[model samples]
Target: MFHIAICDDSEYDLQEISSALQGLRHLGICFDETWYQSGRALIDDIAEGEKSYHLLILDMLMDSINGIETAKAIRTYDVSMPILIVTSTVQYALAGYQVNAWRYLTKPVDPGELVREAAAVLKSQEKSDETCYVVQSNGTVIRRVPLADILYFESSLHTITLHTMREDIEFRGAIRDIDEQLTPLGFFRIHKSFVVNLSHVRRLSSRSLVMVNGDELDISRARIQQLRHALMDEAEREHISSHRMRS
Candidate 1:
């Protein structure tokens, strides 16, 4: 799914954009749209998100903030989002370069043009379905567990405990040893003794990373980037595909 955010002071203009988006739906585009009245409001929403906004449709002029400035600010957090600037005049089209505008549409933007641009954006966003990791335990009682089901792994005195959806699996191995095998599956060693699944992460704090199961794992400074990428929210398209397969 494409997460679209539109900021326009004039409700009429917002509706026009919304209608064009609905046109995409008429053509069978399944996505969601978020509306904002002004650039300031859009900035505030982006501030609260742990992940980057994917697409933004902005009106060039607002009383409080300019669309170009707003896009620049959003780019401060993430540079890859596709930004579409809407205006009656192309006066600020050149200014849009500051924010890496994907396209600039004039007032009375054609529904076909808007729909076409958005379709291209969505196509670019298409990613492979969610990936699952088949985790296997050692010894006579070997079991398989999906990576998404595991909350976090804890390293003990020469043994690792996998806190999972249904049960805890104990294996004779060191945290470092298990981490080597889990990294390819999106697991990160946040702390010296903890290997966590990014999908199950509830939140990441200065000292710990929280899991959906309410368990907290220690976070080491060295692993912050890896943890952030892992804990970031999954895309809607990805979320759907991830649930379709059981590992």
Candidate 2:
């Protein structure tokens, strides 16, 4: 089930959006929603880790903190949740991109359009769930991180550090084990100390690889040819997936 949060100062608009989202239930897109009359309340809840949401529907204009400002604050903590901006004006549409908004809808929203966008957002989340990597510690699941969010894994002996977009997580493990597990999932052991997620590799040279986060990692000479082939296969797979999604 999906968890959604709607933040709007206007009660009428909030109810309208909620009503539109209800249509998703008929399409088997079940979700639980929370309503917030102010952006501050939503931001605080997310900041305190009191709640987690799959999607956020926000109104552009509000009393103290506007939708754009609220989104910026939330991004500091959660970067992957989809943000959908609902506003009367298009002026803030470009601003929404800064927060990686999924889409922007004009006020007096068409119920059909809103439902379509909401469904798409939830569908994408479903896809991401399939690629999530569960992190376990001491036989207990500690975290469920999406593989797409991870940049690379750095190993120093038995300690494996997960370098992600948000932060780094250190755990006791061996790089070889991780490489064997993630190899089929678009990861390559570029060096004995590092297994890089090809999806997050921005550039590659004979000697090293540049990650999306701007960190450079060495590529072992023996693995260069294999890494290049892995990258090519990954690109082809991504291209085919994109085409299928569009069709």
Candidate 3:
């Protein structure tokens, strides 16, 4: 199921688009929709990072800001998300082209076109590479481990232990410093003492992150979003693949 958003000021237009989008359900598509009355509201939502909609269906001419300008703001953070511009006529179509939009959808949209465009964008999200992380130990012997077999990372008074599904390694260092190195590798620092392997994460929330090994660790409130993207989403898919392959 692809998460989607239909943003338009006209209630009548939103209703029509919503109904048309629901029809995609028949074609094995499920949508998580949000109705934005204006492009300004949608842009603010993106800034807060709360409402993340994968596919955006925007009307070209809005009351406050136009869809073209609104898309530029969203592109600042999400350049890859597919944008489908719904315009009244082709005259306004060229304006949306500047944003590098996925498709120009004719206003009073066609059901067939909507379904096809949504499918194409959603299919592109799946990743082929499995992700892997190399965590270096700051000890007498320089050691690094594959992130997949890692259950979690624990920090004591002055040492951090890399807990794996098989074994645990103890190192004398700050977990904070190690976190910087693992940032690109998909390890999220859930707690001050723990930096979790997103791939090994099974269940997670604002309070805690549960590893595949069933070990529970506290989650920092500020890091909840990053942790969510890592574990529950495809954000961790490639990392898991690389680590598992190396093991």
Candidate 4:
């Protein structure tokens, strides 16, 4: 089931957004939503770690904290989840980009536009859910972790650790073996000892990559150009996909 969080200082606006989302059900999209009156309340709930949401719909203006600030905070916890910003003016559109917001809508929002954007985001998420990495040990499945949750993989002498936003799992494996298996699934062998999920990467420099969790991993000198091409290709594909969705 898709989980969504919507935050608005005005109770009326919250209800309107929620009502707009209900229109998605006609398209066979099933989801549950949580409502918050302020950005701080939404941030507090997410920090508690009890819930994970696939999408966030935020109002730009609010008391104490605004939508952009809220999105910035949430990105530290989850870099991949899509955030949709709702506001009254177009002036905040540039600010939305800084937080990597998926879409920005002006209010009072049109229900049809909200449905279309929300559906596009949720459909992409559903596609991601289909591709999961199964962690196994001694013929037993240890865990079936969704690729979206994994930040990166770290390899030591004889142990491979799977690092996610929540916890780390250690298992016996070779980094090369993992690279061969996961490289086809958006994972990159940035260094001999590290393989990172490209989607969770926040910043990439010539020599290192900063992951969503603030961990920096070295990039092999030999793979720098190839990695850059791969990133460019991914961005192009995403652009095409977004265009198709909007069209």
Candidate 5:
């Protein structure tokens, strides 16, 4: 099963996409779709904390944060999720290219087409599941963790603890050593004591960030700007990758 986020200001379209996705279940493509009334509401949820979605369906024309801008904001934190554009106008279709929209569907979307596009995304995720993150624990204990399941890593004094979706695993290591290894895998050192999985960041204040599991971590002043830039870059790459997928 996959989770999807759909954002649209109009109530009619929201229900339409929801119904369309629900119909896909018969084809064995299970999806749990969460609906948002506006782009801001969706982004607000994202900014508030880690509600993960494998895909996004956005409306092009909306008041205040339009779909493209909303998608751009999402791109800053998530670079690979598929984003589908739903609109009544063809003129807005090309604009989606800038946001790396996975596919564009005109108003009154065909249910069959939606199912086909969604199944394509599911097939892709199935092909990528074997990748894992291997790390050492307790000096000699080796652990192979699914990269996506890791929540964050906390270092206190000399011990490092991996807070994952499954459980907390503590081992002897320096934060810097793991930081060097995980940074390339979307981890960010927001503070000296914490290196977080940015994907798990649910909300942030001026001084701290709350992870998906509700644990709050301090953000050092020195790394604040760096963290913001990294998130933005992640979004940019996400949109770019969507285009590549289509190509």
Candidate 6:
């Protein structure tokens, strides 16, 4: 089940958001909601408590602590949690990016817009559940390798090799099929024969990717732009996740 936290100083605004979330239940979305009056309260709970949430809706303005500052504090402990900033002015919208907020809503928030953003976050989290790739090794031993452990997939002559943190495993599969399963989970196809996990990319050059495992993979000339975009996106995500672990 998805857990959501809403923090707003204004009780009226809080009620409005709560009502909108209730309406989502009819559309088959299930979630647990928690409300906080100040940003500090919510931040403290996350940092000090065991409860984990999927999303956070923060008010951009508050007397004690503003949403942006709260989001920054949260980033110090929990980076991947999706944050949606609610503001009455557009000026704070750009500031939201500093905290790596997933999205922002201008007040008064449209219920439909909020629902759309929430739905997108839920879908992304669901995709994250695809963390393992099942393959038959040597045509007999079945294995389920955690996707995070895999550095990259090398394809040649219709035989695919999974280069992981521990060892390499060879299997028969189509590169296209591997791409279909992993691309959505942050793996990038830098060349027709190589698909690298963005999280495992340690360095990048004009024509190659240096993986964390010390393997250098060639980047296709045609996929340079796509690879760059994927790297930037992955860096932001990794920044958040690492902070969470450190905190």
What is candidate 3's TM-score against the reference? 0.55
Report how far off residue 40 is in candidate 4 (Å).
Answer: 1.4
lDDT of 2 by residue, 146-202 (tens): 898899999997888999988887777889988989998999999999998998899
TM-score of each model, paired residue for residue: 0.55, 0.59, 0.55, 0.58, 0.56, 0.54
Best by lDDT: 2
Q: How well does model 4 score by local distance difference test?
A: 0.85
Candidate 4 lDDT over residue span 96-129, tens digit each: 9999999799999999999999999989977865
* Cand. 3 Cα-lDDT: 0.74
Ranking by lDDT: 2, 4, 6, 5, 3, 1
lDDT of 5 by residue, 211-242 (tens): 89999889999998899888777667778989
Better of 4 and 6 by TM-score: 4
Q: Model 2, which residues run further than 4 Å from truth? A: 133-144, 148-247
Best candidate (score: TM-score): 2
User: What's model 4's TM-score?
Assistant: 0.58
The local lDDT score (0 to 100) that residue 140 gets in candidate 2 is: 37
| Clashes by residue pair, model 4 | none
Off by over 4 Å in 6: 132-247
| Candidate 3 lDDT trough over 10 residues, lowest sum | 135-144
RMSD of each: 15.2, 7.4, 14.7, 10.8, 14.2, 13.9
What is the model-wide C-alpha lDDT for candidate 6? Answer: 0.84
Candidate 5 vs. true structure, TM-score: 0.56
lDDT by residue (176-238, candidate 3, tens digit) is 876887766767788889987776777766698678888988888887887666665545476
Clash pairs (backbone) in predicted model 5: 48-202, 49-202, 50-202, 75-235, 76-231, 76-235, 79-238
Q: How much is the lDDT of residue 162 in candidate 2?
A: 91
